[model samples]
Target: MVRWNILPATCILNSCIINIYDEGDCIPPHIDHHNFVRPFCKVSFMSKSNILFGKQIDIVDLGEFRGVVEIPLPVGSVFILKGNMADVAKQCISGVRHRRVSVTFYKMDDSKAPYRFQPDPELEELLPYQL
Candidate 1:
């Protein structure tokens, strides 16, 4: 068995696309909270894709939020986003088909660590918190 160590202030974002399709697929624009993310956010592309980033300005071009990166993530290439790397990743998504999929990582606080940690309190405490 493999052992993975996770600690507070520790966050990890891992992405995997087990299935894929032709080109022209894209993940639409989105913003993931930085404070809640792991130290690393990994986005692994299954096939060739054009991941664009920026704010919608007029109709022709997106505002100069940041430069765009043409990420042609290979089959086994792992892309890690740190610091402001993710900020530039928020732009209108196009070019690829919807068959492409990637994952964003988030670090759940210990208070919500789930069954992996100590067995949470009995039903008394758990039931009330769910609501």
Candidate 2:
């Protein structure tokens, strides 16, 4: 079971591991694809870094930065994006200062429902069935 204190009640249908190497590693501003559902979670590891978000983000070539907002993600922290925060704005991780790994978890869009909510035998045994 994947449990987070910040998001007490979340069901993760899928997950992916991301590796960031050194200061030069960066992901340009972009929104997640439609294959992913809203309210996804990213758990950071190794080092802390700042993630910039806005309608538009401009990354300077000299390692400096500019954006509407900067959200610091500390090691072992979970960052969630959903609704307006996920749809209306774009986000990017500026120059990574150190090696880091992130595990992102989210559900699939409802149109892909048949591929979602697969039953986990372990979780099913641990919890009561809902009506």
Candidate 3:
């Protein structure tokens, strides 16, 4: 996928799934862990949602807002966060109005990544070599 180019080569290592189920379900603004590499990606599904990012975010009773930037993640789209967007700013999903699911892919900081390698046989068999 063209979106894969947004990240440095050989950087990705791990991933997780996130499900937002309510209008008020929100993730408080924060930066990613130091162990994770920069320029990670999130693939959105089910419904659209807005992700807010900024140097600082204010969380009100209902949801967080007033970020320097706001990104609308449409269904079946990928959102890439990198460099200033990833490091200098904090991000969160706020004001979700419907059930939404996202698969987030992260790269481990090379300095902190383990040396051992193991592949999931079932997943390997299911995925094409070209992927």
Candidate 4:
């Protein structure tokens, strides 16, 4: 949670939408920080494929050691989480090798996603390549 003074804060997310495909449409391994704002995120899963959610997330409601989070989500199964949790989920997602589309709904830090008032050449370069 460190912030710089001189360097203008970067617009991590902005009003951008990242949708990639892998034949089986597999996304890369990373966090959802560059999407929305706030310290939380949400995603809606829709597919008949064998969907799996990695990392051991202990749901207070469910008292069981769930392996990977495998969901047979029909068409609109919404999964929500806090910002930090979303980041962790992204890490788990990175290792997934399958065909699925993760429709994410979350926020970013610093500013509201694209908090950058203007343009940042450095972050701009890191933008295209980051996704």
What local distance difference test score does each model get?
0.43, 0.74, 0.75, 0.41
- Model 4: per-residue Cα lDDT over 17-101, one tens digit each: 4444344344333455544554332343434333335455333222222335555434455444444455555333322233455
Write candidate 1's Cα lDDT for 21-128 as tens digits: 445533445655544544444354554444454443122333212225445554445455545555534543454543555554455445545465554366325421
Local lDDT at 27 for model 1: 42
The worst-scoring run of ten residues by lDDT in candidate 1 lies at 1-10
What does the lDDT come to for candidate 1? Answer: 0.43
Better of 1 and 3 by TM-score: 3
lDDT of 2 by residue, 22-106 (tens): 7568777888876777678788889898888889788677554577999999999888888877888888887787887777777
Among these predicted structures, which one has the highest TM-score? 3
lDDT of 4 at 43: 40
Ranking the candidates on TM-score from highest down gives 3, 2, 1, 4
Across 63-119, the per-residue lDDT of candidate 3 in tens digits comes to: 756687988999999887778888889888886778778888886665675677565
Model 3, C-alpha of 78: deviation from truth (Å): 0.5
Worst 10 residues of 3 by lDDT: 1-10
Q: Give the lDDT of residue 110 in candidate 2.
A: 56
Clash statistics: count for each candidate: 6, 0, 0, 13
Measured over all alpha carbons after superposition, the RMSD of each candidate to the real structure, in angstroms, is 9.4, 4.9, 3.3, 11.7
Q: Give me the runs in candidate 4 sitting further than 4 Å from their true place.
A: 1-22, 38-46, 49-68, 89-101, 110-131
